[model samples]
Target: MNRLARQSLLLAGLLLPVLPLAAQHVDHAGHGASHARDPMAAAIAAPSRTPANVARDKYRHPAETLAFFGVRPDQTVVEYSPSGGWYTEILAPLLSAKGTFYALQPVGRNLDGYKTFLAAKPDVYGKVKLVPFPDQLSLIPAGSVDTLLTFRNIHNMVMNGTEAATFKSFYDLLKPGGILGVVDHRLPEARDSALEKTSGYLKVSTIRRLAQAAGFEYVGSSEINANPKDTADWEKGVWTLPPTLRNGEVDKARYLAIGESDRMTLKFRKPAS
Candidate 1:
């Protein structure tokens, strides 16, 4: 080969090895660009879901709750008692491609209203699997879930005397190192002995004990939704506030001033063997 031709051939040989690295960098950039352009990003970024949804004011936790539990866009999550699917609407789409979202409820449970809503929005609701548990969580295989989340539902379980069984089922469903995130209306510490089912509040200590009995380690608690203004003394309970307005005008302004109920953000973990 001539001198110029030899030089060009040598340059080509040198460039070949570096090409793969350059291509890898480009691929990574494209992947990042795709994530940036994702529709869920825009939805999560929108102002309507922030602070809390006005239409569904019950959820007002700080962003730290999800962050603390290491909840990513990709993970199998089972949400318990997804009443009205307020958070479900957010989680289902967020985990659409990268993760799975399952709503576990008892079979024969009255889900007519929720089913109708889901039927209307197939695109959004299709992502969720409504797993039915006949009487317990026997329907879910053991060690199959990544996270189990119950928001404002523990009180109901406690009131119904199902807390122990429910938590045990939660423990059974999660894989080792899985997380359980809970947020619920906080009852006064003093009321643990006296508060009845009608109170709409739960003692944090009682909740901790119940979770511990379920084979989960109490990770910690967060002040994400704590409210000092609430005395846990509402006549209509937590529902007397914004969303439910249960009492229907006796102290509308006074209760509205309180916004949503003060809640407790708790994190629990299943130990890794």
Candidate 2:
């Protein structure tokens, strides 16, 4: 080969290796840039808390219940009667950067305890907002919330004679097409009368009717929190299980095995405009 041609070929061979290296570097950089722009990706990459990591000693189907509600990292969500804020510790951090998290405490109720609890966990719950409700849903602004969630709190309202107003309030707070997710202790169909007002259990059908009456369509139910072993009969009612274990230290082992009460996970949706 001529000297000029040989020189050109040598230069091309040396540049070929550098071209692949430069291409690889650009591809990696692009992938990192894309991930940085994705809020969900970033949240997962540095997850502050997950259901598996939280202390759910009394909550059943923690992960499945949340997933069925279609909770995202980018939506406004309000948790009703967030007693002690167990879920709040995880949720506030999860939605802090990408969404709004509101803890709706009932009005006239002392919240000094809750405020103190939150103050201790600034890193995870820094974005949380405390919204007070005046013992009624009318206090919630119209078309303001994207999602409303209540977990195992319905029975108390029902037994206390506040079920109708509570459901109506839930219906009003949701935006069109928004969701109202409820998880509550379940009462057997035939045992409704005997268990509804006393035990923590409520008939699933009753909940469905209430939701429908409040302008929400019953989407469906889930067995995520069902416990076949729970005969639904306990001396102290649903509180006989762990966390509450209201029986004191007696039969602690047996009750611990029973875990929390059997619950029903129900989803209802407000009509879309």
Candidate 3:
């Protein structure tokens, strides 16, 4: 063969392998860029979301809260005790195209409600997985989840005497450096821990201590759900606020004006080791 032809053949062999690698690099970078783009905006704006849930967005601040937790569409997430699937309505569809969302509910009457909600909305929720929340929390494998979220449910756990255990379970379920996003009614500062069992509100300091005791590092907290209007003292506690209005029609208008209870949003993480 001529020397020029030999040189041409050798050059073609060297370029072939690099072409595939260069294409792979581009695809990888593009995937990460797209993942970093917030999906909450589009998810919250989805046409399929329930109107009732949409109405609560003003108070719940779903988009801001999730963003604070650094939620992404590509992580394996577990929503602990998603009673009635309020956030589920947003999460299921948001993660439907890319990630896994487990609707982890405690074994109880509300289990059927979660099931029915997802069943009725297959297009957006069909990809969701229903996982039971047993007392031991063994349903999930240890160090398997990327994120664990709980909303307005910690007070109940404190009342039931399961708050510590629940936090420990959350710690166990997460992989190293995994996140735990917690949102709950906020008790006024200096409130006694004893009152947490009765009043729906819990002190942010107390919750942070509890999480730390469970081996979670306190990353930070947010006031996205905070309502300074909440005086934190009511004849009926937080239930005296809107939505619940435990007093019934006795002073409904006053409660409506007060709005929902002030809430604390916290983000914690398991140690990388």
Candidate 4:
């Protein structure tokens, strides 16, 4: 080979190792940028959300709560019992553009009202797929979900004696590596466990046990939705707090000051195998 050609070849060999390093740097930088761009921001701030729902953001901490569950914008997600579409307002929009969002409403009167809410905003909620869960659990094929979430509804499951079946259904619906994100009113461990059936609050251990029984790995828990002011003992249970105020006008100011119920934010994952 000519001297110039040999020199060129030598130079190419020397730069080859550096090329991968440069590419790796670019990839790492891009990953960081992705995190900087919060996926839940737009959904949380969307104009379609009702003013009342917006007011609840302080207590809900939707973005942090969802992030703790590792929710993404490109996965199949289901929300169990999206009554009144509180999280629905955020979740449906978050998944509409790239992911599939299912509103798993039970077959009941609330389903009709939820339908009305979605119909009113076809543009935002138009892509939502509604399934009458438990009864219609088969509507979603087994092992198809990436994440299944239930917010503030497990107490009813315990009260109705369907908690086991509900957990089984969730386990069946999630993919082998799927996630279950749960947010519910927090019941102090020292408090009477029986209150779970009557109060809206639930013990974190109760959820962990049920989920573990369903074959999910206990991933972790977050305090994002916790409120220290909530004592979890009230005349009307959790509803005595704001939002429901089941004991309206009796201590309205106190309830309003306490705001929403203290909640436990938990994450569990289906075994990858």
Best by lDDT: 4
- Candidate 3, position 13, lDDT: 97
Residue-wise C-alpha lDDT for candidate 1, range 22-105, written one tens digit per residue: 999999898768757764543354343424453443356424566666677778889888757677767777777788888886
Predicted structure 2: clash tally: 0
Model 2 alpha-carbon miss at residue 110, Å: 5.9
lDDT of each residue in 27-127, candidate 3, tens digit only = 98986666557577778877888797788898999989998998889888999999788899889878888898988899883988888888998888899
Checking candidate 3 for backbone clashes, the offending pairs are none
Using TM-score as the measure, which candidate wins?
4
* lDDT winner, 1 or 3: 3
Residue-level lDDT of model 4, residues 192-268, one tens digit each, is 89899898889999999999998999999988998999999997889889998888699899889988999999999
Q: How do the residues 76-142 of candidate 2 rate in per-residue lDDT, one tens digit apiece?
A: 8889888677667556765897788888877654466777777876887777887776444454577
Worst 10 residues of 1 by lDDT: 41-50
- Candidate 2 local distance difference test against the native: 0.79
Better of 3 and 4 by TM-score: 4
Better of 2 and 4 by lDDT: 4
Q: Which scores greater on TM-score, model 1 or model 3?
A: 3
